[model samples]
Target: MEANRVDHLLLHFFVIVVGLTAILGKLIELPADQLVAWRTLAAAVVMGLVFYRVRFFRQPRKVILSYLGAGGVLGLHWLALYGAIKVSNVTVAVAGLSSAALFTALVEPVITGRRHSKLEVAIGGVVMIGLGLIVGFASEFGLGLVLGVTSALLAAIFPSMNKRFVDQGGNPLVITFHEMVGAFVVCAAVVLGRGEPVHMPTASDWLWLGVLVVLCTVFAFWMHTWLLRRMSAYTAALALSFEPVYAMVLAALFFGEHKMFSPWFYLGVVIIVLANWCYPVARKRQAMRQSAE
Candidate 1:
């Protein structure tokens, strides 16, 4: 039980890391597309070293393609997510992304070919209410809101793919390694096609980029992989859902007066967090009852 508690705590920390990724993107003054291209490139380098150490790169072609698919999702997710930060402030971008679990609820059933669970839908609806509040308070929605939502939907695709790939005997580390590479390739192609030189980031830009790659991308994903091994998937996903709450708090702390939204914003966040946190618990209970029945 104590081990479970620790795993739970670590997953929550992962949420914070992802949430704060937007802050890093906002602080660095670069085009969102270019930023994602560099981030994917950096993450690929880190994953490559890990790949060599694990010797997981020796896998067959089919397995490698699976990694590329996952990576494609990863690339698109970052592209949209960073684009959200570019078009809007970090507060609105993060708030909009809080709807990820709602997206997941809908996508998971279709992908897994399982009957849609009522509890999951209910929880998703609740989270939507929370998003409504956040958007209500921050009424200056723009292209960023649409991009943020798309980013989140793309993010939902990867986790389920992770589970499927692992279940099919794919190497987790290799999957991550190749996915990062795939993301880098896709982003680079997009950046280059834009007919602009890859914006050469300065020392300070590199510094913040390192923080994002090391702390958020590398460490966060590694911790999440570790937690997945120790805890149930539902528990892991539920804890991960707190990303918006964690992000919003950090935005307020870092941005101070500027990040502060109206009272409606706080209320919306509360509603969303409540929905995200409650969804898994409800799912777990339903599973237990089914077992007994």
Candidate 2:
């Protein structure tokens, strides 16, 4: 952890920005699909200027399609996440999303052909338990919880696949650029097919969308890609487990969401966050045991 102090700090900052997405999502009036479509479309448009000089067409066709496919997964993930938010509050949506750490423990091994880490899997279970405690047996959040977990599944997958791509010498910025374009296409198609009204954003919506595109999508997307170069996908996903904490806190501040939970909420928050912070220790012990054996 000390060795990668900078990466850890940057990851926290990224989580903060990601948490803000829920706040913005709640603020925006568009349906979930439309919000995702607009965000992806606007992000691609802005990011094009950054990588326009690159010869994307000359790049490998298979690589382009692969990144695009991953981006499609990303599009669906965002929609599910925002859908959860629309159906329920930010706490319910984010708490369910925290399970991505566990899903990554399961998925990353299968996707990357890596051996499963018992410690990581165990930590992932703890994350799920913590999430359950936070959400409790509240039947009201059932649909939202389901969608949030679905979001977690997709969220775990693409980053692992993207890490494989990045390791195979894919340029992170270019990959993100292609993926955003792909997300926009997938989301736009869905929006059009649903016959949802695609009216232009009003002034307030534009302000929120602008913040979302420039900060949350463009800057955050690039930063996420950059972080991948320095860390494993599982580590990244584990760190993201802390997203709910930031989101819960932000929701409290912005939406007065604190009163909605029981006393178990604080305990659950502590447990989930401790799971993330425990990663470095768990990883070191796993390596030591492996080497000794």
Question: What does candidate 1 score on TM?
Answer: 0.90
Clashes of each: 0, 0
Which lDDT values do the candidates have, in the order given? 0.75, 0.88
Clashing pairs in 2: none
lDDT of each residue in 17-101, candidate 1, tens digit only: 8888988998888798889888878987877765567875688888888788778888998898888888877777777777777
lDDT tens readout by residue for model 2, 1-293: 13288888998899899999999999998889999999999898888776688665567889999989999999999999999999998988988899999999999989888899888899999998887886674457989889999999999998998878877888877888888988988899889999967877778989999999999988997888788888888988988888888998999999998888777876777898999888889788878988999
Off by over 4 Å in 2: 1-3
Q: What is the lDDT of residue 61 in candidate 1?
A: 86
Q: Which pairs, if any, clash in model 1? A: none
* lDDT, residue 139, candidate 2: 52
What TM-score against the true fold does each predicted structure earn?
Answer: 0.90, 0.95
The 10-residue segment with the lowest total lDDT in model 2: 1-10
